[model samples]
Target: MHLISQLCFLLCAAALGNAVVLRPRDPVKYQLKTPPLDTPWTDKVGRSPWPQYPRPQLRRDVWNSLNGIWTYQAAAGAGDVEKSPPLLPYAEEVLIPSCIEGGISGLQKWGVTHMWFGTYFEIPQEWNSNERILLNFEAVDYEATVFVNNVRLGRNTGGYFRFTFDITDQVKRGQLNSLKVFVFDPTDDQSIPQGKQTKRLSHIFYTPCSGIWQTVWLESVPKNHITSVDISGGMDGQLNITVHSNTRQPTQVKVEIHGLESEYATQRWGFESDQLAKISVPGVKLWSPDSPKLYNITVKMGDDLVQTYTGFRTIKSEVVNGVRRPILNGKFLFQFGPLDQGYWPDGIHLPPTHEAMVWDLELIKGLGMNMVRKHIKIEPDLFYEACDRLGLLVIQDMVSMRVHTNARPSDAEQAEFERQLEIMVNEHKSYPSIVTWVIYNEGWGQRTDYFPEFKIVDRIRVLDPSRLIDAVTGWEDHGTGDFLDNHHYADPQCGTPYYSRLSSPYDQSRIGFQGEFGGLGHRPEDKHLWPVEGAVRTINETYEIHANTDSYNWRAHVLLDLLKQQIERYACSGAVYTQTTDVEGEVNGLVTYDRRFVRVDTQQWRTDIQALYSAAAGRA
Candidate 1:
């Protein structure tokens, strides 16, 4: 009976054209390429690289993940791309969410700029009943024009921020719907916030991600649904929430706040579109790296419901003794962590799985670090969620772009840059873990510092006055912002000055910070190294040591002493290590790129960090 039923199902599927069965699992047909080093989660990446819910802050229960094998084709040239959709089903296949350049994508077509990605999805009957069905893309590099059922939906321009489109009119209910996307990324060829992506991959810069590199999904929302929620926590116990809706009419919103650990009375408020609502919670525990407490919030208007979480904490700068310090919740605590370059050996710009991202955070926590300088790249919401849940303070950096060599951006370019910056702040402002925003890194894409009227830093301050602003992390200093930052990659032997000239009294209003230091390089076994043609081991004047347990311990000890000196002697409030993992040819990370092993002894590292924290506490 079982065999007969299976036979009947296959016959029926054949009768219906077998769209689900003939979804193309044969990799040879597509001629895909795999990376040399595979992460542990690489094989587990079956179809979807990150199948989890894309939006954690604004989440609905019923959603469909449009991730899996997708039809892929590299355009013949720029002229090959046209207004209409690409030819129906391409012979090549690429995995969604993973860029076409990365190994996890199954198509390691690196240099192709123009490409077409097509997939088919079914709109559930229940989803069709909703007033609106939305299609969302977590991120697409450079430029993207989307099409649903061959009908042009819209286009998005940013590579690091998420965008959505209403596909209610395009999708067919209870039937397979066609989705096509065209992406063009001119990494170094254009003046954009390309981060470390470059046409030439060498030194600090690594691989370039071209197409869809994050999650893609479909959501069912009401016509008058809640669009956004801006939650801000104050030191005075007041929780300010501004609930935004699509409808202009005033609507009754029920806000339910539940403490994950502590008991708190639920508060209610009536929400109007674009109006601010305030509520004070009694005995609110301030969120810190030590005790990161989050409150689950549910916002419901009419039939629209969305769930989100936020932590209440206050961040400010105050003079402790003679030196200014970043104070959190009216207390002084030194921040120290690695500069996290969110890159993977297999996935390049993205981690292979959600668990992989969480693993990196957990490793940082276990190493006794309190903060992470997310260097020059914006991660997905899942990264921020893990940081909030695990109590890791984040220093987010706006992606940098040097339009011209050490030159100012034209007026038109500056406007677009500010637009992207505003989107970055508005999208991630609700996350309590983000304490500082680094505006310019190593003078990338920065105008002449002499021009006080440039006012990019001022613009950011206007957008978000809650978090501290870092005008410049290294090299060129505008003599503004809350941190007098410097990037000093001292010699591994401590032969060079640990601090730079930025520590002078010229900026009395800013706190001293070692934005980057200690690029101690150590290449692991050949298996862990990223395989690239003519890939030279670009080790700085750091250290040359064996990859043994004892050497790794010594390296960790030396690093601790170096950071301790910065805190005690220079009164530096924070310091960021060169990086978390090695990228491409750079082998100066605490961990290998594949994430299979940690070079340092976790237990010893944690013990040393704990001692450092104790000393810092006494100083505070």
Candidate 2:
């Protein structure tokens, strides 16, 4: 096994590739927001703001909290675009750990995209030179650049994955040091994976988020520290773990395994060359969606220790018992669940809280869904962690920034799009719950900006051969992708089984899953929503006082009824219900926008879901 991130940084150098580059400073920017919280005991002078522990995967003690009220200013979207803007008064005040666009961030999640944030802190004189500094960002949209005082540290792209910078050399002990970050995001632009984010909130897409969407903090580590680690164990009685370090060489590297009943499991091993080790046991326990059994894992190169967990499972779409089905642990199991469009009413791109992350799947479980297709947007890693622990299967979708905006990057744009896509694939390829990858959603932004790109089917196939990939979701079905899929709005026509029969040459199923259906509307009251609710509106909000949707609902309900008719009519495979909750103005979610109300009774809804999934599981 190699460093999970070995390929993550192997960009063809500009000297070799002669790539065109842009100085992000060319765009106007906004300074950061630092709102003062009103906590009775959470005053800025005393308590540590955002003092919670950072890494949930590997827990530890003795770290510092860098979140708190900080100074900020907005840069002229035009003036001196290449340089940080000077501080301005009454610019904006917001909470440290929240994005400038999120409600909790003490900033609105609307009408703001370009901005910069800065904060200053003094290094404690008592701290020794033996300690190294680690500056971590949970997430920052689009592009980011970091500077200490005035010296450039490092830069990072890709909004989904966590990025870090070593600032030890820039910070002088016993002296005040300033940290600054610049961010720019074209919400609906043809670059970057903005997921369903839009400058204007509506329909399915919610408000856009700029700057930090997650948490930011500072940590002190020994000079020789563990940079990163990838822990994965497979079902064939094989376990693979790799550890990355900041030093050139280490004296020793070792890891211990536990949880398996066999004594061979609870032992230690050591190695070098990126410090990865492999262990295989005979007759290992296999993990399935039904029984999501995970094991404990520990890693240590020297003095540093990191703990995590891994599940042993393999996913495949197979014809078992003469039926095309998603096989898990060597058994046919219908993958069924909500189309999880991870969004929030108040926070937009940001989930309101950490627990806010689990509601989508918890509601799915309540509705008897064993699996979920996390449509179009890759969620924060915590969401996957919950799926791994909660026993729900996930078909993760890669984000699309240019899809809705009709972005047709010239061959140049297309090339950049591919690069961004590669970043997405490598960053998220490791999760156990992700059984499939969705290359395109409804062909939103095709390369032609018109026709479909059959090559997409091939692109997805190459990126992640370990899992299933769907090149396009709604229309223009290419004879590629691991499965078949289509969208039906007012007629819930679940697709056909004959299609599954056509892919036998590839050992793939012709049957396509209903990538979308069942968009029943039910909005929440007093949600403080953004203006211009999406076009997916009732089309006539008051046409019928008591009716679902005067234009789409009554017909949508009848369409769902029609779909149920077709489920048994076509003898289909499976489906992913339109959405889990209402986003912005679209009220199609199973739960209301506030997440406080369930549109349908929990038990009855679950039963409805179970029937659709089980029936579609086996495509004969």
TM-score of each: 0.91, 0.80
Question: Model 1: runs farther than 4 Å from truth?
Answer: 1-32, 79-81, 128-130, 260-265, 403-408, 449-454, 491-506, 540-552
What is the per-residue lDDT of model 2 for residues 1-620, given as tens digits with 9 covering 90 to 100? 13432222122112123133322221122332222211111122221234556565554444566676543445546333366433221244445666566545555545555667766566666655688777788777767777776567767776766788888888767655667777766677545567777765444555667776666777777777676665556767676666677875754766666777765557667776265467775545766666777776676656677676677877777775554666666665666677887766445555655556666677787667777888766666677778888888888776765655544556765556566667666656556777777767765555544443467556766655557777667765556666667765424445543333212112235554677766665444443222343533532341222233344344444554555555656634567776787665666666665566666655555555556655544333
1-620 per-residue lDDT for model 1 (tens digits) = 25653454355344334433432332234433568778888777877557788888998988989888887888776665565565445557788888788888888877888888887788777654857998989899979989887778778998999998988888768767778888889887877898888877667777888898888998888888887888888777787888788775778888887763355466655655467787877776778899998888888888889999888899999988776889999988888889999988788888888888898899888888999999989999999999998999999998988533556677676677778988999999999999999878887787673543238668877777788988788757757788877776542211123444543333556777778877667767888888775455454333344466576568767877766665665566777877788777877777888888788777887887776676667668
| Candidate 2 off by > 4 Å | 1-55, 58-62, 78-81, 84-90, 122-128, 200-202, 222-224, 246-252, 262-265, 273-277, 282-284, 404-407, 449-464, 495-511, 523-571, 613-620
Evaluate all candidate structures by whole-model CA lDDT and list the values in order: 0.78, 0.60
Tell me, what's the RMSD of every candidate? 4.5, 9.6
Give the worst 10-residue stretch by lDDT in candidate 2.
Answer: 34-43
lDDT of 1 at 393: 96
